[model samples]
Target: MTMVTPGSSPSPDPDLVQTILLSLRRKQGTWVAWAQGCQTLQQAKLTPQQIFEETGFEPIQQNQIVVAEQVYQSILKAGLSDKAQAHFDQRGSDLLYELRVLSQADRARVAEFTLKHGLEADEVRELVKPVKEYSYRKENPPGFGDGPGDAIAFHFWKLARQKDDLQDRSRLIAQGLRFADSDGARQQIETLLTDFTVVKEQPAPTLPLYRLETETDLPRIIPVVGQMPLTIDDLKAVPVAVPENPFGMVTFSGTGAWIAVPGWQVIFQSEDPVGLLTRARQLPNYPAEAADEPVLVIVDRANREWQDDGYFLVAQAEQLTMHWSPSPIDAPILGKVVLILRPKRILDEDYNRQPWQLDE
Candidate 1:
């Protein structure tokens, strides 16, 4: 054998070493290099081939040494196994299984813990997007015992008693009336009666009393009037007209002023023939005194030749010749002439009147 050089170092490729170690760990069910292999190497001072032989690990092929060197460098970059060991310890293999098997009590405990840690269930559920349906159901389980209405009534009654004012108490009674069933209404009424009765039954101081009159008599009375009969001729004498110009003068002659019948005219030798004929159709009757007066007349001169006639009398006036003007006229005329008549104030007269009666 040739004499070997002392203190000469051999360069071992890191990739080749890591590949060998990884194969050995997989086959042996452990990361042997990082655990037993690295420890043995530090203590024994053996070459890679010697270590493989001594540990029963296979030798890496010469062609695969570069791949092994790459893997070895990666393993070194990933650091130690202790960090991984700590992680596995904290989150054990059965974490998901534990969550799956959790009871209602366990879920409540989790919810409480989350709340204590400032992680609200409502907020978390909103964020998670697609949460398991069962989780939501567990969080909001159905309530037990008495319905919501009873709780509401109890709180309302408590608040009413705290206020202790009569109006407040009355309002509470009204609210109870609105919500209560027949039996509940009766119960509430009885409760109120019992409370008030207790106060009334207790002894109390007396106050001064005053006596006042409570009854008196009052009289009722009605008035009476005498009746009078009227004839057709008397009714015809009443002044009535569908006035042409309500404010303008209406003049009549012959029997025109004495009869209330419509349509009569004055016959004067100098009068316009067309105007007289029109007037004959619109006049209201007046009495003997009015007949002697100069008649007030409204002229309808709309038709250029006076074909449109003015109002006229139905009957002949005995002696009345009336002249009317807005201002004073000479001896035969009058100023501001207004026809005055006593109104017939009979109730239901229009309803009772016949067609012939209207003409009368």
Candidate 2:
């Protein structure tokens, strides 16, 4: 009976870890105890796989329990009602896990709402997203308060207003009514449903499907150039490497080229366009053809509007380079990166070595 006080030491005692592992196999503890044991095992530098092999808990299950335990502790610290505390003393690990993304105060409030409604894990999962998003808003929308129901009502009300179709508006309004605690919140949604008149179907989304053949519908090839200051003539002089696939094979021969993707219509429309050859190793997590093989990154010189998620070409300290950011970079603008080319995987590399082994 090795005694281990939880959170007593940053580095857990080895004997305590062994005791917890043994207890886990016998199924002799609550989820909270198991969570603390898993956390202690992790603190002892045990890998998730090692812990999984020692105990029957999978990595994801271990993660859920650890996070759920943390959320439960926060709820307790926030001072829950006695009945609410009792209700969650042993159960609701999955529901609590879903509340991990929320703030401590919000977690406590949502916990009580969850218990009051007797919410299943799936419903709690759906409920948490709106509550988290509502907290980010600068001001609470009209007819909504700081309560959990108000957050959910605000979410449904916003959706109902966005929809032009009567069916969508009605459905969203119904959802608002189901969770809304205040009279003001319900009144606003009821008004919206009663006033529903016009109906417009959302436009069908277009599928990104393109047909490619050798001669007629071949992809345009854009050549990779060095990171140098470019003039209009240099942009014009660079040949648009049209596909020279003679025998049903696209061959990339001299001065590495990337087939122009149909998705780069914005790049095509640019007054001046050039491809920048970037070392794939330089970009984090980008797969490289070879360790030194530079890949073609197409940029549109005209489109320099800063989008948060977009990658851009910038000139800093007299050197042209690629930059990606949600915030503005303190550098002169060159172009917006529109396309990055990754070479197709060579699936027949083994076949090239062993010519007659087609049975594989």
Candidate 3:
């Protein structure tokens, strides 16, 4: 590995820079290894000033060196001009400061994008900056859930993932970033909701179903299909037990209590959250499905005893995005209607069901 020192002229060549930066990790193993060295020298009675002066290395936070080297590598891969390269070396610490928020996996991905796209070092830093909530109703496209969003509108713009008019919808949403918030640009926000893939409901759940029985002392338990627009609170409260196995859950059935249903993963996302609960309350109280034969019930708007029209359920199937949970309360709030897999039939002739995971 090449020696890199302060005030030394750094190479502009992308390949050379990447090689030297990559070697930092291999030789030192990880920033933690360097930290261990610091502790060891101190244990040997070396003073902090003496250690830095003699050993020629200062103690660094875990991943600090890793992040520094990573920044150098990204700068090289970005193929920025010489001035930009110098800017990166000078601002290396700032880039690291910005990257502090990313997980190891996500930080690596940002580096990968830097390498792939040849973004300028500064641009690369800005690209991974986490997007906070920027609400633009009607004209806005989407908000990344839970985790931070990438600042690159191009990144999310590419999420259209299919060829359709929805591509325009995505582009329009991205537009909100540049134009929507500006004066007089509010009219440019696209009000038309893009139609994602229309979900198809299978008559039976794809997985095998074991009867989930409620305990005698507990409240009556019933299992509802995800096609029913149940909220996150409702799904978590579904009498499914804390799973002993990845595919196991405690549930209730008419004939027994504390029933164990294997091969079911409880997961969720909210698509049409506003009306989800309202629809659920109006649902016909059918035995969720026949015992031993789980069936799919797409919970859109259902009619109960009423003479009303245009009544929207607070929580309904149309608002769901994705849900695949085994236990309960663990489903991710998807914030909008997407698609959910309702496993109506999760078992077979021999009474065994291998859990099937549906990637939403």
Backbone N/Cα/C clashes per model: 42, 0, 51
Candidate order by lDDT, highest to lowest?
A: 2, 3, 1
Off by over 4 Å in 1: 1-145, 181-190, 196-360
Cα lDDT listed for each candidate: 0.31, 0.70, 0.36
Q: Tell me how candidate 1 scores on lDDT.
A: 0.31
Q: Write one digit per residue (lDDT tens) for candidate 2, span 205-264.
A: 221112333223334454656458977777776665555332122235455544444444
Q: For model 3, how does the per-residue alpha-carbon lDDT over 1-360 read when each residue is reduced to its tens digit?
A: 112222333424555333433443344444434444444444444455554555455534323444465545544654555654554454444344344334443444454444344555476455553231111111233432222233344233333323256656567456434322222222223232344643232221232112333222123334664676778887776565343221132436444433222222231232122222112212222244533222222223322212111111222112232222111222223332222222322335244334566899
Q: Cα RMSD (Å) between model 1 and the true structure?
A: 51.9
Show where candidate 3 strays beyond 4 Å: 1-48, 58-63, 66-98, 119-124, 131-140, 143-151, 154-360
Q: Evaluate residue 165 in candidate 1 and report its C-alpha lDDT on the 0 to 100 scale.
A: 70
